[model samples]
Target: MEFDYVIIGAGSAGCVLANRLSADPSLNVGLIEFGGSDQSIFIKMPTALSIPMNMDRFNWGFESVEEPGLNGRRMDCPRGKVLGGSSSINGMVYVRGHACDFEEWREAGASGWGYADVLPYFKKAESWMSGEDTYRGGSGPVKVNNGNNMKLNPLYEAFIKAGNEAGYPITGDYNGFQQEGFGPMHMTVDGGVRASTAKAYLDPVKHRTNLTIMTDMMAEKVILENGVARGIELTSKDGKSETIKVRKEVILAAGSIGSPTLLQRSGVGDAASLSAAGVEPVLDLPGVGQNLQDHLEVYFQYKCKEPLTLNSRLGLVSKGMIGTQWMLFKSGLGATNHFESCGFIRSRKGLKWPDVQYHFLPAAMRYDGRAAFEGHGYQVHVGPNKPSSRGSVSITSPKAAQKPRIQFNYLTTDQDVEDWRNVIRLTREILNQPALDRYRGDEIQPGLSITSDEQIDQWVRENVESAYHPSCTCKMGDRDDTLAVVDSNCSVRGLQNLRVVDSSIFPTIPNGNLNAPTIMVAEKAADHILGKGLLSPIDAPYWIDEDWENRQRPREPKNAMM
Candidate 1:
């Protein structure tokens, strides 16, 4: 088959590209997905997120190489193998990261990627439930609903109240004028169903006749001829192989791990590494699989004094009731992911923006819902937003079916260690506040005995797990950057008609969840691919504490409370 664009991986970015690029009606666009259809009931039910995340059928279940810094333990890195990619299996939180994150991207040679330049794309992708504003989008594809603060369990209120009592400012919307504070989290959930990129971008446009979505098709390699990408070699589930030619471009939207591995397999990566893996090198880009980064979080669990947590509802009867409610009316406990309230804060003074992020869950359970506490309990999922430690994703063999070697090298730097210490310290302080005094119980995960920096560091090393936000394996930067795989326009360096539009193109990891930002990247890239002029940069003001360099909290009393 021949098409105008052949997008590998019908994930977050590919879905958007499919919708936008196929709008011309005459242009043919093919979106290939390695995973099967996202038609499972668990995928649509917001609270059933853990089902897809833990299922091998839906999750790639990639594990990192044993990290020297993380006490030599291998960390599980789950990426969505299904249609929406990680967005289909991620915690349904919607965060765009601090505006400063985009500014840093621009400063780091990612031209046209500053906060002012990227904000328009962010706004263009969202249909926020809170209505339209200079900062929030209202008429976009993705449906972003505000967490039901009033109807949420009391634990969410206590979490936010504790943040205020702890002297942190309370911003009504973290994605609005200010991001550094406690507030209701926005979720990519509309009417109690997940609003994945497939649902928002692809589903609406699938009937266009010009867009072809092929699921269960594994992309083996990019078909390149004389430094130009021409097509993709793919294998079907039934073991049939075929090459589909592309007339315009071949965009790699396979995500951080998948994209880098595909590039290496296609002989577009480091020559030495590719040669060692028995693949002849077509291009010698050293950065194809370097600069890997992710967020590592430890759940700070606390037994609840009151029985108001989700722990009380883990029984079979409760599960049945919740499922029945959702299946019938799309309400009850199954309606939300229960990460209703969350915050972003600085660990200490002198930071330009919030370096730490929080997702408060009213249950002491892991992401996969394993090892659940038997009684009422709660936990704060906290982690550093940006870690200085870097790693790489490299192919161990020439085969596309083999999982790539992923090494995040977690807690390898002093800043990363110090940030973990602070995250634990600040989280403990928040849990001990008067607002939570009614619900807070004994600490469960780290325990009260773990007080010293050394003990905290040990706990972090032993317990930290990927927040599932792996990114930057094929970073976008100026062509002058020695390690840059893609240019600022997301075009592959030293290659023609090939581009990468996914989280892997991030110049640096953002300050929050990656789903929203990945969608924004595809939106921006679509404009570039169509030869359209860039969106006019908006000068929307973001919240900044006047004394941020000197103090963690603002000096104004009004800023301290909602």
Candidate 2:
């Protein structure tokens, strides 16, 4: 197979790249994924986000080697193997983090990727259901909505009020408003159905003559000649090995774990490591698998004394009614994305950026797909939005694409442990608020026994899990950066016509969710590759600005919200 653009891993970024690049009818684009079709009914249902977490058919169920910092427990890191990638299985919370997050990227070597520079691309990729305004884009493929129609619990309301009481302002929109306060989460849903990247971008262009989507094909290696990426070698479903040629460029959108591993296998990584793995070195890019970062959350679950949570409706009759409702109007419980409300907030006073995020669930989340919960329980998941600890992912073998070396040095530093402690303390405070008093129940995880920083640290070590956003493996930076794999324009440093368009290229992890930002990266990268215009600055969202009062001007609600 030959293509003008051979994009690996049709995940969030890959889907967007395929759509934008193939928009030109003359360019042939090949988008490949290692998982099967996204035809499962569970995937279309919003609550089914967890249904595929353990599903090997559509999930690349990879685990990290036992982390000494995390009490020697290996974490299960799920990357979407399907057409939509992690976007399909994620909780669907739409967040771009603080403006300062990108500024840190600019300072770290990714020129033109600061908060002001990436703002327009954010606007360009999003069709804000809330409206077309300064804070949002009206004409984009991906749908963004505040999900205000969904009812929020009184305890949840108190959480926001608690934030206000704690001195954080009420941010009406996390994406539009500042990320420093507490508020309801905005989601990528259309009429309550999950609007994934495949749903937003790929589906519309899948039938285009210039586009080719290949699923169930595991990309094993990139074919490099004279320090340039020519094509890729992959294994088909039947275990047949084959090679695909590229005429112009080979784009690696294989994600944080896959991208770095594939690079090492293709001989474009750390010289000593590649040599140890029995592969000849092509480019001595030391940072290909270094600087790995991910967000970890500790969920506090409690059995609600009142029988009003989603667990109360788990019976057969309620299930039948939900099915009937979905059949009648494509709405109701069946159409709901698991996360109803969440917020980004600072854990301490005087922090420049938000350090914690919350995922307020209507029902208790059972980590293992088959595990059973006690009763109707509500959960508040507290996760550190950004952490200082860094890890790495490396290739262990040259042939088998099944295994990779993933070392998540979680809680490696005292700063990381302290940040998590503050996050836990804040979560406790919110749960103890007056609004949460009505839903009051004893803590099921840490309980009252956990108070000291060391106690919480031990609890977190036992309970913390991945929030599923992994990035910064093949970081984008200046050529002078010895650890840089891609340039600011997403081009691989030493390889010609090879670019990495995925979360792996994020020089620094954003303060919030990574999906929206990843899509924004592709939106900007497309124009960069086409040489359509000079890269421009992206303004921070109006909410995050210091001058929030002036930017919150009135607008046409219908159009702006739409």
Candidate 3:
């Protein structure tokens, strides 16, 4: 089949491109997804997020190569294989990262990617429940709702209150003027269902006759001809191999891991690595899979003194009741991911922005809800948002089915170690506040006995897990950058009629979850793809404590104690 644009992977970015590119009925767009339809009940039910993330049918259960930094442990890296990609299976939290993060991107040779240049796209993609403002978007495709209403769980209140007691200012919205503080988390959930890119962008336009979505079709390689991308060779679910030609351009939205692997398979990566993997090199792009980055977090579990935690509600009867409520009325415990309250904070006094993030849950368990403690308990998933360590994603073989070799090389730097130590120290202080005196219990994961820096370092090495925010495998930057794969326009640096619009194009990892930022990237790229002029940069002011240079806490509030 021939189309104006052939997008690989009907994930977050591809879905957005499909909807936007097909807006002109005269243009044809084809979207390919390796996984099946996202029609399962488990995907729609917000609380059942674990079901899709842990099941191989919905997730590409890719494990990393043993990391030397984490005591030689192999970490599990799950990416969504379904229609919406990782957006369909990720924790529903919606975060745009610190504004300065985008500024850093601009400073790192990613022109037109500063905070001012990107905010307009971020605003354009969100329909925030709280209404429009200079900082928040109100009339957009994705539905963003604050899920941390105190009425949902008392622990949320305690978590925020504890932050205040710990001398941190309370910002009602972290994705607003100020990102560094405790606040209600925004979720991509509307009416108790996941608002994946497919639901927000694709579903609304799926009926457009100009757009075609092919699920269960795995892209084997890009059809490159004389330094230009022309089509894609893919394997159908029924074992049929075919080539779909693109009349205009081919966009690779296969995510951080999938995108780079596809490029290498298509002979567009580092020549040395390609030769070793038995693939003839078409273009020697050394950065195709370099600069791999991700967030690693460890759960800080604590037994709860009260029966208010979700553990009490996990019984079979309770599950049935919650499921019934959600199935019938789209309300109840099943309506939320229970990651209601969260925060972002700097690890130390001199940092420019929040380097650490917190996701407070009312239950003490792993992300997949396994290994529950015997009684009521709670936990906080905390980690450094930006790690200095860098890694790579490389093709191990020429075959399309073979997974790429992912090595995050996590915790290899001294700054990473220091940041992790700070997370634990600060988290312990917050949990010990008088605000949580009523609910705080004995520490569970890294108990109080683990106090020394050496002990904390060991605990982190043994327990840290990927925050599932892998990105930057094919970073965007100035053409002069030796390792840049794509330019600021999202086009491949050395190839024509080819571009990458996904998390993989990030110049660096943002300070929060990747879904919101990935969507913003696609929104921005759509304008570029259609030859539309860039949005006027919005110079919105973000929060910065005047005393930030001198103290950890803001100085204006004289009575505030640090």
Candidate 4:
């Protein structure tokens, strides 16, 4: 098969790129996914997002090889294998990340990636469920919905009070003006179903003449000739290997794990590592699979003393009511994505932006439990906004089907340990706040007696796990930096007609969830590739004021620009 643009992996970024590039009906675009379709019933349910955590069919249930720094215990790392990729399985929290995150990317040699430059792309890709206004877009494939019919978890509100008591102001919407404070989470849902990238971008365009989407097709390696990427050698579902040529470009949107693995397999990685893996090095890029980062999180679980949790409504009556509600009005608990609320807060007073993020769940969740337990319980998931620890991923073999060696050196640095310690403490403080006093219970994870920083650090090393936001493997930087694998445009340093359009190209992980930023990258790259218009931002409408809350949406162009 031959195409104008070949995209590997039907992930968040891949789906967006496919939709944008294939908009021109003349261009032939090919998108490949190693897994099956997103036809699973549970995947479409808003609240069942976590059901994929230990499920093997839709997830690459990769685990670290016991990190010595993390008490020699391996932690589960789940990457979505189906269409839409991780966005299909992730908790549907809509986050654009902190504005400073992109500014930092620009400072680190990624020239055109400052917050101002990326903001327009963010707006271009969003269809705000909250409403169309200055900060939102009205005509985009991806849907962003605020508050579902489910009642707000009280614990989430209490976190806001706690933060205020600690002197932080309430940030109405994290994706809006401020990124500090606790509030109800905005989810990527359309009506009552999951608004995944596949549902929003790929599914709607499946019948398009220019796009060809293949599922269960594994890409083994990029077919490089001399120093340019020409095509890819891949094995189909029946084990038939063939080369698919690309006339224009080969884009690797295969995510953090898949991108690095495919690059190394194609002889575009660190020369020393590729040689050891029985592959000849083509680019000798040392940073191909280095600089791995993830948000480490620990869950503070408690058994509720009252009937406020999901357990209280797990019976037949509630189930029937939820079903009827969804069927009738597209509302109720059935539409809820379990992560009802979240917060961004600093562990102490000195931080510029919040260093810790919280996920409030109204249920007691155990790892891989056989049966669900319901009660009036609330969970505080403490995640480090930015950890200084870094790790790497490498291909263990030349085979396409084999899983790569993912080494997440969690809690490996002093800064990481301190951040985790402070987050855990801050979580406890929020849980013990006056608003949650009636619902609060004994500390079960680390227990209340472990007050010392050393004890807290030890607890973190034993319990903290990945939030699955890996990046910087094929870091984007300037040609001057020898460690740089990809340039600002995401093209490999020494390879022509080859580019990476995924989280793997991030020079560093953004300050919040990565999905939105990954999509923004594709949106911007699409304009750059299509030669649609001037790369500069079209001046913001004078009526679309900086105060987005009170501003009216600018009138849309009749046919919309790509």
Candidate 5:
């Protein structure tokens, strides 16, 4: 098969590219997905998110090669191998990192990607339920709505109030003008169903005559000739191999781990390493998979004095009822991801933006859909958003099917350690606030006993888990940088007609969940690929603590005008 534009890995970015590029009718777009359709009810229903994330049928189930920083633990890295990619199995919380995150991107050589340069694309992709304003889109492909747009659960409101009581600024919407402070978090959900890229961008455009989607087809390697990526060698699920030609460009949307490994297997990486791995080196680029990053988190738990948490609803009968209600009406407890409340805060004073993020869930549980406590309890999922530690993704062989080695040297820096300590300390302060006084019980994790820098450090090493936001392997950077993989336009530094889109091209991991920003990247990239001029940047205002130089947090809570 031959197409003008071929996009590998129909994840968040690939789906968007397929829709946009194929719109011209003159452009034939082929989107290749390693996994099959995302039609399972487990994926369709937002509450069943955990099932798909852990299932091998939907997730890549890639595990890291023992992290040295985590006491030699090999963390589970769940990348979606299905139609929507990770978005199908993700927590569905929509967050675009702090505005300043893009500034750092520009600083790292991803020019024209500053907050002002990229914010328009973010608005272009979002069809927010709350309607359009200066910062959000109202009628875009991806449907986004405030988590629990209605105040169905008091816990959601309580968490936001608690953040205020703990002296954090309370914004109406974090994804709006202000990214800092406590606010209502969003989910890519519409009509009680997931708004994954497949559903949002691909579903509506699937019938386009110029677009072809191939599922259960593995991309073996990019077929390069004269230093130009011409096409790709693909393997069918039944082991049949075929070559598909690309006339214009071959886009790699295989995500952070997959993209870098694909580049390596295709002989586009470190000359010495590729030669050692039995692959002829096409380029001497040493930065193919070097700058890996992810957010590491721990659930700060507290036993609830009252049975207000989701733990009480984990029983089979309760679950059955929730499922029945959702199946019949698409409403009820099952419709929500239950991460309605959240916050972003600076770990220390004088920081230009938030370095920590909080996802307040009503149940004290692990991300694996397992309860940590047998009774009613709640937990605040807190993590350092801006990590300094770096790791890598590299190929040990030339085989396309072989999973690449991934190591996200998490918590290796002193800054990381300090960030963890501050998030934990602040979480304790928030949980102790009068807003939670009636419901809060004993601290269940890191306990009240796990105080001090040494104790907190040890506890974090033993308990912290990956937030599953792996990114920055084929990071975009300045052309002169030897370690830079892609340039600002996402074009590989030493190659032609090849580009890497997705979080893999991120120069730095953003402050919160990656789904929102990844989609934004694809939306922006689609325009780039189409030769369309960028949407005009909106110089919107955002919140920054005016007293940050003198205080880490407000000394008193300000009453929000209702």
Candidate 6:
């Protein structure tokens, strides 16, 4: 088969590219996925998110190779294998990342990717439920809203109010004007159904004659001719292999892990490593899989004094009611992911932007919805967003079937370790504030006894888990940077007609969930891929603590009790 554009991996990025590229009838666009359709109810239902996230049929099932920083433990690395990719299986939380994060991208040689340059794309990718503003998008493919507006449970209210009681700023919307504050969180959901890329971008345009979607077909490698990507070889579910010619460009949207490994398998990564993996070297790029980064979070659980948390409704009958309500009226507790309130704050005084992030959950249970506490309780998931530690993802052998070796080296740096210590202490302070006086009981995960610096470090090392935000494997930079695999336009270095449009091209992981930003990247890249004039930069105002250099947190409560 031949097409003008062959986009690999029908995930968040590829789905948008497929919809945008195929809009012109003159161009033929093909999208391929290793996993089947995302038609399962678990994928469509917002609250049943944990099911598809851990299910083998929808997950890629990648794990770290006994990370040295996690005390020789292998962390679960869940990347999406299904049609919508991780967006279909994630918690549905929507975060655009702090604008300052894009400034950092510009500093790292990603020219034209500063906050001002990319704000237009971020605004274009979503149709926010709150309606159109200077910053938020409207009439877009993806539907987003403040899930349930934290009204179903009072615990969400307590968490945000508690942050203010503990002397923290409270912004109305984190994705909007300011990010360094506590406020309501947005989710990619509307009318009780998830707004994954496949559902939003692909479903409405599937009948287009120029577009083709092939599932259950794994991409083997990019076919290159004298250093130029000419086609891509894919293997079917039944083990039949074939090469599809690329008449225009071969776009790699296989995500951080798959994209880097495919480049290595195509002999485009570090020459020495590719040769060692039994692959002939086609190029000497050494940065295909380097600069790995992710967020590590530890859940801070608290036993509730009242029967007010989600735990009270964990019985079989209650779950049945929730499912039935969603199935029938598309309302009730199943309509949202229940991650209503969140906070973003800096760990230390001198940092201009928030380095730590928090997610307030109404139920104190494992991520898989397995009950951990016997009765009513809640938990705050906290972590350092801008971790300094780096690692790599490299192929073990020249085979597409083999999972690549991943090592995040989490907490390997002293800065990362110091940040976690602050993360636990700050979250504990927020949960202990007077707003939670009526509901707070005993500390659960890192108990009240775990107070010392030594105790905090030990507890964090034992309990910290991946936030599922892996990125920066094929980072973008200028052509002069040796570690850069892609240039400003996401075009591969030393190659022609090849580009990687995904989170993998991110120069650094941002200060929030990667879904919104990943979609924004693809939206922006679509213009470049079509040779259209880029979106005009929007210089919108953003906020940071004015006295940040002198104070780590607010000296006194900003808002009095209402």
Tell me the TM-score of each prediction against the true structure: 0.98, 0.93, 0.98, 0.92, 0.98, 0.98
Instruction: Please estimate how well model 2 matches the true structure, expressed as its whole-model Cα lDDT.
Output: 0.80
lDDT of 6: 0.92
* Candidate 3 weakest ten by summed lDDT: 553-562
**lDDT (Cα, 0-100) at 59 in candidate 1:** 94
lDDT of 6 by residue, 317-431 (tens): 9999999999999887899999989999998899999989888999998889887779888998899999999999999998799989999999999999898888887788778
Candidate 4 has its poorest 10 consecutive residues by lDDT at 552-561
Candidate 1 segments whose C-alpha is farther than 4 A from its true place: 555-562
- The positional error of residue 418 in candidate 1, measured at the CA in angstroms, is 0.9
Q: After superposing candidate 3, which stretches have Cα over 4 Å from the reference? A: 555-562
How large is the C-alpha RMSD of every model relative to the true structure? 2.2, 5.3, 1.8, 7.4, 2.4, 1.8
Ranking by lDDT: 6, 3, 1, 5, 2, 4
Candidate 1 lDDT at 284 equals 95
What lDDT is obtained when candidate 4 is compared to the true structure?
A: 0.77
List, residue by residue over 453-543, the lDDT tens digit for candidate 2. Answer: 7898999999998888899999989978888999998998888988998999998888788999999888888888777885466454444
Clash total of candidate 1: 0
lDDT over C-alpha atoms for residue 36 of model 5: 94
Candidate 3 lDDT, tens digit per residue, 340-385?
A: 8888888788888888899999998777777458998999999999
Error at 115, model 4, angstroms: 0.2
What TM-score would you give candidate 4 relative to the actual structure? 0.92
lDDT of each: 0.90, 0.80, 0.90, 0.77, 0.88, 0.92
Best by lDDT: 6
Off by over 4 Å in 5: 556-562
